[model samples]
Target: MHKIEELKIWKKSIKLTMLVYQLITALPSNEKYGLISQIKRSSVSIPSNIAEGAGRNSNKEFKHFLSIANGSAYELHTQLILTIELGLISKEKVQPVLDLITEVQKMNYSFQKSLETKISILNTQS
Candidate 1:
């Protein structure tokens, strides 16, 4: 993509972050700083890292950033599960968020693989 903001992955990540923010708003007052903070940070990291990585000059660096973004995505996914288990959110309430996360994860994986291929070609060229 010419611009990080133009990438579908980035757009999806933004949507996912917004969804998480909405979900956390409904959390108990006590968790406003605990689970709430953690979830928001992790969710935001997904898109933020993607944009940061896309700004890098090298494909390798971009791939590294994408990897970090993927890691953050998994972290958010884990937290969502924890939220369900802790009774902080019902399975129904969390389902839409989970679906969005899954979609973003799949897109990230596809983009990562594409980056890997491009990087391999670039390495060969050099």
Candidate 2:
């Protein structure tokens, strides 16, 4: 199992989730059950999946969870854009969060590739 605390991706995801929570507070109350709900879930999913994958017994399992996390990151990305397009938030306020999400996405992709490489090597040896 991996130490989630030491994983830069996991750390960034946690920060991303926190930023999302902060952003949602400025949104309209009417959206509490709509976009707000969706964003909250997706944002939390990023870090949650990372922690889950880190606890798993195998690299393949971890990679699967990381994939789920990355999907959440993209989903969050779209939702953030929607907030801008809907006029609920300004692009300036949301851009930093978006940039952080992108960073998390890139980190996830790199981490997944490393896991894939390990899986391939183990399979070859087997």
Candidate 3:
């Protein structure tokens, strides 16, 4: 198992989650049970999945969790864009969060590829 605390992706995602939380607090109360709720879940899922994967017995399992986290990041991206289009939050307020989510998604893709390479190597050796 990998040490989650040492992973830059996990750390960055944690920061993303915190920033998202801070950003969403200013959203409309009516969205409390709608877009706001989804945004919160997706943001938390990113880092939470990373931590979960890190505790697994194998890299494959970790990669699966990372994939889930990446999916959550995209879900968050879509929700953020929707919030902007709906005028629930201004683009200026949501832009930074979107940028961070993009960064997390790219990092996740790269990390997943690295894990895939490692898995391939192990398979070839076996």
Per-residue lDDT of candidate 2, residues 59-95 (tens digit): 9999999999999999999999999999999999999
Candidate 3 lDDT: 0.95
Per-residue alpha-carbon lDDT of candidate 3 for residues 1-126, written as tens digits (9 for 90 to 100): 988889999999999999999999989999999999999999999999999999999889999999999999999999999999998889999999899999999999999999999999999999
Global lDDT of each candidate:
0.90, 0.97, 0.95
Sort the candidates on TM-score, descending order. Answer: 2, 3, 1
Better of 1 and 3 by lDDT: 3
By lDDT, the best candidate is 2
Error of 3 at 35 (Å): 1.0
Model 1's TM-score against the true structure:
0.96
- State which candidate, 1 or 2, has the greater lDDT: 2
TM-score for each predicted model, relative to the true structure? 0.96, 0.98, 0.98
lDDT of 2: 0.97
Candidate 3: residue 10 Cα off by (Å): 0.3
Question: Which whole-number lDDT from 0 to 100 does residue 24 have in model 1?
Answer: 87
lDDT, residue 34, model 3: 97
